[model samples]
Target: LAKTTQPISMDSYEGQEVNITCSHNNIATNDYITWYQQFPSQGPRFIIQGYKTKVTNEVASLFIPADRKSSTLSLPRVSLSDTAVYYCLVGDALANQAGTALIFGKGTTLSVSS
Candidate 1:
């Protein structure tokens, strides 16, 4: 299993962009690194996923290094509403696997201000 690590917190102003990076040194071949964003009371929402390259969506872009040891999540033009906890999950790619659980650690808290 790949053990993941990330920053504890970040500070950003409204309308600014933010990027959070995560490290997973022992990532397995069957494992995928996923990024999720969570607000104060809501569940973490899937942001992006990648194996060994870059993946982008309407909300964020995930950049994986060639070694697959780390990844970065880019958030464009963050706002006050974007302030939340960001988590990086590393596990099996199979979503339906009953044995797989999204183990979340203390996420990076992005504090967006005016």
Candidate 2:
């Protein structure tokens, strides 16, 4: 499995945009970069994903560099309610693979203030 590294925390005011970057230098060719957002006690929610270039949705945008070693999640006009932990996952796209369970570590915590 590829190892991911992200920031421990970030601060943003309401209506401001926030961007979190994560690094996975040893990502496999078949793996994809996925981002998840988690509130205090709830499970993480899927944010965005990308193989290369860029992928965007209503929630956020994912930017992948040419080397595919790192990715970024950009949230637009965040609110106080957006305070949460952000996670970056780099793994096989197949759901039924030998190692399917996503291994998590300390994630980046975003603090949205008014």
Candidate 3:
């Protein structure tokens, strides 16, 4: 995966919007980003953030700029249960081609309060 930088922590309240960004300066032209949300004692949730496709799910929306060097995961009206560590990793498409496993670095912790 390409080197990425994300905020160490963020805060939000219920009914408020939350946006977490990640920066990957050296990303390839064809690279795709896959986001993951992990809560304590639970596995990471998958979110496909592709450059070609616009993905908008009930949980969140993934936005990538034209340069593909940065991305933001937008969570609309989150609740307390939404608190988790969000991660963005580059080269997910590459991993699928090579059958490689995912390696997650320290992600941004989102704390949602009432």
Q: What TM-score would each prediction reach against the true structure?
A: 0.92, 0.93, 0.90
- Provide the overall lDDT of each model, using Cα atoms, as 2-decimal numbers: 0.89, 0.89, 0.85
Report the number of the highest-TM-score candidate: 2
lDDT of 2 by residue, 1-35 (tens): 78999999999999998989999999999888888
- Candidate 1 local lDDT, 39-104, one digit each (tens): 988988988888878898899989998888889999999989999999999988785556667799
lDDT of 2 at 93: 83
Scanning candidate 1 in windows of ten residues, the lowest lDDT window is 93-102
Ordered from best to worst lDDT, the candidate numbers read 2, 1, 3
TM-score of model 3 relative to the true fold? 0.90
Cα-based RMSD of the predictions, in order? Answer: 1.6, 1.6, 1.7
By TM-score, highest first, what's the ranking?
A: 2, 1, 3
Off by over 4 Å in 3: 95-98
Clashes of each: 0, 0, 0
- The residue-by-residue lDDT of candidate 3 on 2-86, one tens digit each, is 8999999999999999989889999987678889999999999896566744578778898888788888889988999989999
Worst-scoring 10-residue span by lDDT in model 3: 47-56
Q: Candidate 3, overall lDDT?
A: 0.85
Clash list (residue pairs), candidate 2: none
